[model samples]
Target: MVLIIFFTSLAGNALMICLIHWDHRLHMPMYFLLSQLSLLDMLLISTMIPKMAADYLTGKKSTSFIGCGLQIFFFLTLGGGECFLLAAMSYDCYVAVCHPLKYSVLMSWPLCLRMTLGSWLLGAADGLMQAVATLTFPFCGRREIYHFFCEAPTVLHLACDNTSLFEYLMYICCVLMLLFRFALILTSYGLILATVLCMPSTDAHQKAIATCSSHLAVVSLHYGTVIFMYVRPKTYKTTNYDKAVSAFYSILTPHAEHPHLQSEE
Candidate 1:
């Protein structure tokens, strides 16, 4: 099941990227953002899935310190980028639906490129900060991480020193990354809904709803698991349940987002 999801997500995202690149019709701002999404999803899945599959197949569940750090860095980089990218996508939808006349002016190619670049930079910054901070802690005995990947929380849990202060700091960062972006998405869609309801044409309402629905679905899947994993109360720490939720977002969310690619196509 894991391998199947890995290959499917990889192929689907790669194909989406290719189609957008080669097909001129898909060269619009919306598809451009989508292609960036495909690229991010592809990179994100590749960061962890290959190593995870190899570990599962060979029964060797160990990674070097460097390998683990790289995993955490790339995981946070791509994951954080996706959060911002999803917010940008919602704003794109809002502009296209509510302010169609200014969409080209508002979401132009250069603006899209800037948005994409900003997402990558922000995500990389977060990843670098967290990776350095997380790794600086001295990991003591019984370093067997309970989760499948070197997720920051799982690894942080092994610190020999007091991490309560660091965990609080991390929680604040997570809130800013996850909740802030989610709130932007909701606000964008809220405006979209208001605009749609005011439209006299039923066709316009249907079209706007149809376009936004896929994005909402993808956002729900991605944010639900991540918020549960990172933002939920630390008191709710169950290793097994954490592993299950981690697998859900790591493997399943990308697959779920693939259908949106087809819908856009």
Candidate 2:
């Protein structure tokens, strides 16, 4: 099942990336950002899924200390980058819809490039902080992680020394980042809604609403599962259901960016 999910995601995201790269008509800022997202999704899922499939198939669950650290680093960095990118995409949509006249000028190529790069950089910085905190702690005995992936909370639970400070700090950072991004998403959509409502052309209003609806669906899926996985109570029991939820956004959402599908509309 894990293998099935892994390959399916891998193929789907790869196809999206190919489609975006092959089509010159899809070179707009929206599609460009989405292509970056597709690339990230491919990289992010590949980081853990292949190892997981090998482990599951071979019944070998052990990961070296260094391997575990690298997994955590890439997982958190890519995951955080995705969240920031989605928020940026939402802002792009809001600007395009609410202020169509200025959209091109505001979201220029340079600004878009910076925003994309900045998201990754910020995510890497956050991951670095977490990695430092994680590696500094002593691990005396048990190192078995219940989850297939090396998640920070699960790893922290296994530490022999106190991780309360590190965990608390991580929680603070997660909450602040999530809250700020959620607020930005909501504010952008609010302005978009107001603009759509005031627009006299019914057809234009409908088109705007349709675009927003698609974005809202993607946002809900991505943010909802992440919040559920991280914010909920941490337990030792292994659950396939959690993996399924993670797979949804990480694996499925990138396929929506395919140029063929986008062009069909």
Candidate 3:
């Protein structure tokens, strides 16, 4: 199952990148954000899946201290980047649909490049903070992480010191990514819904609604799972059930979006 998920995510994201690269028509702001989304997913799934699969199969779950730290950093970076990318994509959709004439100027290549660069920088900052907070705690020789991956909550539990600061910081980061951005996405789509409804023809309204619905579905899949995963208290421990939930969003949703990407193309 792990191998299947890894390869499928790899292929699906890679396909989106290639299609956008090869097709001139798909080289717009939306597709550019999508290719970055694909890239992030590839980096994200690669960070944990291979080691996780090996651990599960070989029963060697021991991870080096430095390895765990890097894992947490990369995971948080990509995860946060994914959140910002989705928000940017939502705004792109809003601009394209709400103000079609100005979209070319507003979401031009330069603006798109800036947005993508900003997303990565913001994500890296978040990750660096969390990594520093996480590693600063005394582990007291604890090393076993309950979940398949080295998640924030799981790692924090190993710390022997007061985790209040790290936990609070994590909650803030979670709110920024999953909650705040989700609301922004919903707001963007709400405007899209209203705009599409005001279309002169029912066919146009339906077509616009269909497109917005697809993006909303992907957004919901991501934010819903991540919110559930991260919004818990600091003392939260990982269960196999939690790992399963993480696996669902991490492995399944991007592949599901493959069909939508193809249809849009």
Candidate 4:
């Protein structure tokens, strides 16, 4: 099942990227951002699923310390980037739909580039800080992470030192990362809704609704699972349920994102 999802996500996202790249009509800011999203999804799922599948097949659940740290770094980096990228995509959609005449100027190539670069930088910064902080603590006992991947919270569970304060700090970071961007998405869509309603043509309203619905579905799936996983109290015990949620966002969400990317084109 893991291998199947892994291959499907890879193929789907790769295909989205290629289609956007090869199609001249898709050279607009929206598709450019979608292609960047596809690329990020490709990297995001690849960061964890490949190693996970390998472990599942080989019966080797254990990874070296450095390997674990690297996994967390890349996973958080891509995940964080996707969060910001989705917000940027929402704004692109807003500008395109609500201010079509100004889209060319507002969502210009340089601005798009800046947004993409900003997403990556912010994500990298979060990933680096979390990875370093989570791994630095002294871990005792068997040091086995209950979860499938080296997620920051799961890894922090093994720490011998007191981490309550740090866990609260992590929670705050998750809130800022997830909720703040989610608020941006909501604001963009709210404006979109108001604009769509004022349109005289029913056909135009319907089309706008259809497009926005698809984007919102992708956002809900991604954000809902991530917030459920990371935004909770540290006192919460890790369970198979947590693993399932992780799989949803880490594996399934990327696959879900593919259709939305293709639909944009």
Candidate 4: deviation at residue 16, Å?
Answer: 1.0
Q: Give the lDDT of residue 76 in candidate 4.
A: 93
Clashing pairs in 1: none
lDDT of 2 by residue, 1-265 (tens): 6567767877777787788789898777877888888777888888888888888789988888888889888988888898898888888888678667777798888989999999899889878788778877888786776677777777877888878777767767777888789789889988888887888877777778767777677777778777776665445334666666666755555344412111111
The local lDDT score (0 to 100) that residue 36 gets in candidate 4 is 86
Highest-lDDT candidate: 1
**Regions of model 3 farther than 4 Å from truth:** 234-238, 255-265
Ranking by lDDT: 1, 4, 3, 2
Reference-based TM-score of each model: 0.94, 0.88, 0.90, 0.94
Question: Judged by lDDT relative to the true structure, which candidate is superior, 2 or 3?
Answer: 3
Report lDDT (CA) for all predictions. Answer: 0.85, 0.76, 0.79, 0.84
lDDT of candidate 4 over 141-211, digit per residue (tens) = 98898888888888887899999988888889789879999999999999999988888877777777766
Model 3: worst 10 consecutive residues (lDDT sum): 256-265
Ranking by TM-score: 1, 4, 3, 2
Tens digit of lDDT per residue, candidate 1, span 101-130? 777898898989899999999999999999
The residue-by-residue lDDT of candidate 3 on 1-265, one tens digit each, is 6798789889888988999999998877777888898899999999988898888889988888788889889988988888898888888878777777777888899989998999999889888788877888888875776787887777887888898876887788677667788889999988988887777876666666655667778888888888878887645634776787777777676532412121221
